[model samples]
Target chain A: MPFEEKFHLRIPGPTPVPLRVQHAMNRPMIGHRSAECSRLVQKCSQRLQSVFGTRENVLIIAGSGTSALEAAVANTVAPGEEAVVVVTGAFGDRFAKIADRFGARVHRLDIPWGEACSPDALKSFLLSRPRVKAVFLTHCETSTGVLNPVRDLAQIVREHSDALVIVDGVSSVGGVPCEMDAWGIDIFVTGSQKALMLPPGLAFVAVGPRARKVIRQAEAPRFYLDLQAYQEQLEKETTPFTPAIAHLFGLEAALDMLDEEGLENVFARHRLMMEMTRAGIRALGLPLLAEDAVASPTVTAVRGTETIDATALQKELRRIGVVVASGQQHLKGKIFRIGHMGYCDPLDVLTLLSATETALHRLGKPVRWGAAVAAAEEVWSRV
Target chain B: MPFEEKFHLRIPGPTPVPLRVQHAMNRPMIGHRSAECSRLVQKCSQRLQSVFGTRENVLIIAGSGTSALEAAVANTVAPGEEAVVVVTGAFGDRFAKIADRFGARVHRLDIPWGEACSPDALKSFLLSRPRVKAVFLTHCETSTGVLNPVRDLAQIVREHSDALVIVDGVSSVGGVPCEMDAWGIDIFVTGSQKALMLPPGLAFVAVGPRARKVIRQAEAPRFYLDLQAYQEQLEKETTPFTPAIAHLFGLEAALDMLDEEGLENVFARHRLMMEMTRAGIRALGLPLLAEDAVASPTVTAVRGTETIDATALQKELRRIGVVVASGQQHLKGKIFRIGHMGYCDPLDVLTLLSATETALHRLGKPVRWGAAVAAAEEVWSRV
Candidate 1:
């Protein structure tokens, strides 16, 4: 009687864990200090390094993406240090808040919620705060469906100061292109739940040479989120504390699945699916939250009409077996987000569009039946 | 070629996740802001409250048990505030470290690693630190396999001072008896792993009225670990940030499984299994880590002979398909841990003891054949 209800995950993150991943998690338990666990740690770390495109150490923590971000801030920013955070959406603001919490003097460069920070804005922000030790940016903000120009911002930070560049690539890594070494990114961190098609519980942090040096000098108060401690233990293929072992099992399977698809093919697939979703939404006469050029290729945010309640529409969609995410804070109720990342294909896009058409019509938004699906079908046919 | 090998988890904290929990985790993702997610949150919170014996509020975070402990410290202790930590083992030291990380003035009442904190010692410590606002203690220290007297410590803290009594019940809650309200415990927290029979990703914090009031007054920079924000969103069955949804699903199933087994029966089974393990170890000429009165029924630490290479013995057992944890930090190479919590039964204890005896003998630690198995069979028959 307690679990009679059934629900499905179509939201952007914590996506339905793949069956293979779930099976991987069902393996017997092992001791954390054993050589076998250390071997796993070594193998998993190598996979993560290859994924992040870095030769430096990769640290895994038992928390969401935000906790990894906190570790980055607490380890890079010393007391009385300063940093520049380019804020375009909720996650960017979150990074800035974390820096502030670590006692760093944060200089925020705020942009519109649905837009990304311009490279020029970041350059000027760094120039104004000449003593800044780090520049924080989000590769793809899930809340507003915006993808920033991370390479350009990193270049700007390099030109203006000796500050390290940190990126929150939570929702973009597996679904989009992010070459950490090529972009000169000092630190790249992500969560397992997003594009990795794994359950939420583990976070990945990829450190570069500069970030490593900064961490050695950082004096921020930290214990559980300590990247240095993790790095040390990882050298022996273990964690400083007992980690979410089942998550590691699931992640190993996820990485295998990603390899089977190939990273490049996965990125291309995600982009094409996003196009299909966008074409479907645009065909229905709904405005996209951000301009097409700056919109993320992982999630499409459709600006709904004022007459329709986005929350109610989401609920109605759920009733019909579709799950979508609503906007946050200022953008709440103004737009509905459809995710096209991790385990998604053209068929998924079509199903969501069809559901959206029905929910819109049910809410009196006056969308034509089959029109959105037709647009999606056209994209799928070409694929 | 990279994943040609397979691994298992026989650790105490990140125990093996059951298939039922894994299936629950495979549920579709839901939007954190959606009403449906709020329902999931509400349901998980209510069930969590029932398990913790609390009626006030329970919050979930996407981290290991350590992250929850750090959050409790960051949310309960302000800068320059004073607190007392009863150190019975490594976990107690971890609490002190977390408190110091947040700039709290900490006073430690240190006890031997394999012993419980004396109620009189805690009272004396509180009497000495009259300005203390919190007293930290561990319900079960997985490191040394010692179970602290939670009720005794809580009573001492309440009687001696107005300090909030926080218990890290990560390894004990479901396996042993934890009467939060009757014991006057202000805060009780546990992780999803261990006796919960779920994967490691979710942690629960159940706060009583007094703990909630302390959180309201306590201020340290927090965002992701902000208990206030979690409580606020949890009131409506929502989370302030994106939670580990799949992990929650797993937790819901695990809790249901626990309920089906019945708490009293589960506790009894665990005790019976522990007794069987101890009897087997004694037959093998192994010394128990803790005194019988304070030993944990969940995990038992066995002291090995000076000539016995505990690490090699652990490896040999693992190679033969049995996994047990080696001691941590200073205790490493001297002690080995055997866990009998969550899904473990009398048969498992016998099998483990048999395998351990063979492994030790192979590693030059002599023991008569069938001695351990015979001892364990006798205990199993008696029970």
Candidate 2:
């Protein structure tokens, strides 16, 4: 059998899509320039505003999440302009690297792997470098499972400098409570595959007025990701180029599901899953990479013991029909991650903990059978 | 009812996807880093090579066709380098504009709207400018429905100068005969929605040795559409960023269908459709935008008479449960297009021509009923 039909996917992004969204992909193609297509695009853009928690329209691009991040950077900071990027993990480093590629003079503020960036440090940096044009932040870093304090960091940037606060909410947005306007975020970028319960194709970015002003004046070299062109086309309820029509269909269905469930309830469910998973891991005598206060609601990263190899654990779980993500880049084989972001419930968390317990026991590690699942169930029942 | 369920998509791109490919997209999401996902990606890359007519693997990006075009320019031409772009229509002008955005000193070789670029003109230009780093050509101009002689143009570039010949086969590749290795084309880019019988999210590019050499040394700013990172990740049978996994499933099914029918038969089918469409238009006393000798096999552009407005004709056709594309940019309301590529067949051509006749008659234009369909059926029966 194909792995897609049998394996339980628990990767951070590219999360398991719901059946309704998958079925939505079967909708036939439409003429993109037709009036019907324009109406469909217009409706999708309006619905996306609610999820983004912004009054402004979100710019949708037919690309991966990285392209959206690049667009946010390319549209705001011109070449030789200064920007501060807080690097807490691999994805934070990616944000900084993208800015660097666009000829921005990036100032890397490095935080430890499993820790979030301090807002006071950012304030001091902004106070010293008042000429910085933008401050890049990652709401949730998938590599270390750390949820940075974006609201506090954005507030500090607003108080100390005129820099735009750009947030990479790729792994967090729909799962966590990210109020873009309330947080003073000038540019917020997210992917469709995470808590959106869709496949990995379309990316969304909500640009505020300050970022729009910078976009008009920025001399960045861009064509496919030009925000001004997208803005102009948005008025006509279409994109400048052919978009992913099937993905847009799926987005409509997914957004309907999100709206039906209520955004606050969805966030609460994610928070419950995170607590249950962490409780289960602790009961299994495993240490989480991120501290409790900064742990991400989307994914949980657990550090491996001396006897446990992360890749081996992943493969062992795969044999038992569960799929999880391993550490990325420098942390490979040292940590493992379990994602419970989209379309996940209490029962799903119990299954993941049960599978981990079995895999650890089969690998000759000292694991108490049923302890992890029982602990998760206790947290679940209370929630 | 939604237009997706009933509309006959006759646009130049975002073409009609086959039922099998659409069904394939319903497959459940798998972990992108899993072994199964790796196998799927490797198989896709190999099958794409057969369609691209290249010995090397094709680079697949999770973006629109324009993103693939940007990658071609960003990888080969550095800032301050000289390049030549052949502009015959909107997409051609887009290619030149992207190079200019990347700071390349672009030499625009402007051809007439409805005419193909002559190889002799390109040869003379190349001889005069020996320092030209790259030459961009559009294989099929979807705007004017003209097909350029890319093989001959690449041969001239190889003989006269050391410039790399890059071809945009966006609307042509699978429906037309474009042998990348045999023609000495350095880079060939295409989209999934046109002839690949899939949705519009994925873009494919087949790179030759000469272009790879230049890409290694090119200093153009890029991160998401970076070819070097893609090349490195291709070794691991994966992409640098998350790809459109649902499209990959659809692509596998579509490629299987193409292989079952054979590529030669696919090209022959497109040719037959083109002949039938042209014969039908001529029988209805409609002039074609492109001359017969240079007409494209994928799409047909027809000039509208003063009695008939192109957009109104398109809207009238839509009311009768068919959808056709009107001319783009300055040609809007002057000409209309009919796309008969990918999953289209002889019967589809007959239906399109019949609808055109009905739309023209309803608009009070003098058109003979059944004459156009009979002309198309004559060509179809002969085929």
Candidate 3:
């Protein structure tokens, strides 16, 4: 059995937190406005700018990832504005819904669930919209395990429309490279739970000068989600509100781990894990939800075949103390997802494959002992 | 010396978490939508309702205390509506500001900084603002350390105005008795950092039937702050957004501790600590910001005199590895606040008082070496 509590967590988010990070978060609480907390906030915020690939300061909000997503919408598009959202999966639909909730006329450029939105498609979508104020894109759609080409889509948005390029990098940042300035991303948002190797609480938003200026000018009804207030407070080396202080402690440790590993190596490791997971699943004759060209390095969705029930497979895996995520929204019970980000390792992936092979065979599928594990081992050795 | 990390934490919020709760939070991460997570959420929320003194479900928000305050305002007051806000201190002013940000015509019922809103004053204020759609009150003003007479004020609101009573119980709920239904408060909110013995991340909002109805009907633009959707998903024993799972683990442990202590005993313990703190401060010939009757049980603010500088005294205490809160906003540097809630014992308070005494003497005040500690001990023995 896996240590520290029981089940092996292989979800897209709320990923495994390292022991160092957990120990860091277990430190005693301190005054939020004290000098020590100020230093912690400033240092953590500074270190995070590198992961986001932005020179601008990242605003840390003590909220869920969706709070950052909603903040992006609430600060930019005012009532009666026109915004374009690329809908590729559940999170994409969420951005569009958030925009619509904020009274903006949202034009969703829907792409196939398992496919990335092409640059040409985004360009044509923007051309038709004519007066789009902002364009929202998901860097990694967790629901379908599709990694949209955000850089290309953002370039198209810049060339075709005078709109703010907002990208939800909730499941992308830290596990992958995000060149916010280079990609012309006006606003980029990410969560702590995915590749940051911390639990879910903090949401980081990197706002470029253009987005900050627009946020300052926009007259939206927001007090807690106000980004401008966060900026003003950051100049004082403190937060606008009481931050998730323990999470910051964990964040400092997580950042140290990421720094020690080096971000480039971290991304490469995630890629290797992804390759391992895909190979093992494919060796079991499983159907992948996303094309290899557009597959997410963080999470891989494996569709259930007619012979195998995804629900039963998930349940069997759970019985063996292996926990992978089931499909979300409309795809529920039809597919399962394997997470390969954050603190996950090759040995952990091998164990998961070994367990999955047992689960499938136990669920009346053809017996294929050692095949899945061997396939993953082959990928690991090749890498 | 205080163990775990270093200094003694005496801030009003981000209170010192118990080691047990910290250990609970340090448990391994798990899939957010798994059956185990759902069970944790249900059990934690169920245990929390008793502390809130409500039969309604206490919605757990993965955000700051400010987020819950804003959620209450956003869910009830529509744009261009009229509301009455009783501004007693910083938090009360924050509620008024949130209403103003949300485009409501807010009539501020300003009270003196160190005083609570009297029922007569509130009745008169409500009578004058007959068309007020909602009335916002702060149950505990953390800045001034004033615990308002919420039960009485809420009664007056029900009698005099057709307004929904929304209370910011951020610093009050877990430390004091909050009879939400009996007090006629339509909405009540608190945070994990205060008397909950957890870090600053989760916000709990207990919504009454009236508030829920109004929230569903209110036309304010919100997605992440929308409480109705939270209720809908909660029927399935899950949160609408990804919750702070580690905090939920901590919450379960904290609630277990609270339950084991028995809530009445917990409240009395906080009361005893308050009496000890106030006695110790008075014994040192220091002035308290709030009067004895309205002084908060969770925190107490000590004002500076002509002979002593509050800032210098605070720095001296910090030199001895003790941490307390400086006054916020206009009161900064004039007063230093001592928190006596959550995971704190009489021994902690005695140490805090003793450290405070040494700091006062070092700051050139005529200090009797054992006077403050003796006074606190007397109170503890009597209680």
- Which candidate ranks first by lDDT, i.e. highest? 3
Write candidate 2's Cα lDDT for B284-354 as tens digits.
Answer: 88789998889999999988766667778888888777777888878988888989899999989899889
Model 2 TM-score on chain A: 0.98
Q: Can you give the DockQ of every candidate in the order shown? A: 0.54, 0.85, 0.87
Range of the 10 consecutive residues with the lowest summed lDDT in candidate 3 chain A: A1-10
Residue B162 lDDT, candidate 3, scale 0-100: 76
lDDT tens readout by residue for model 2, A51-119: 778998798899999999999999998889999999999999999999999899999999989999989
Task: Give the per-residue lDDT of model 1 (tens digit) for A1-383.
Answer: 13424444567776766778878876765555666578777788788776677777889888888888888898998767888888888888899988987778998999988888888777766777888888899999888889898889988888778999999999987788888998899999999888888877788999998888888776677778888888788887889877777778778898999999998888889888888888898898888888778888888787866676767887787777777888877888888787888877888788888888888887778878999899988887886
| Total clashes in model 1, counting residue pairs 3 or more apart in sequence or in different chains | 11
Each prediction's total of clashing residue pairs, residues at least 3 apart in sequence or on different chains, is 11, 0, 0
* Model 3 lDDT, residue A162, Cα: 83
Best by DockQ: 3
Give the residue spans of candidate 1 off by over 4 A. A1-10, A306-316, A363-369, A380-383, B1-11, B306-309, B360-368
Ranking by lDDT: 3, 2, 1
Better model by DockQ: candidate 1 vs candidate 3: 3
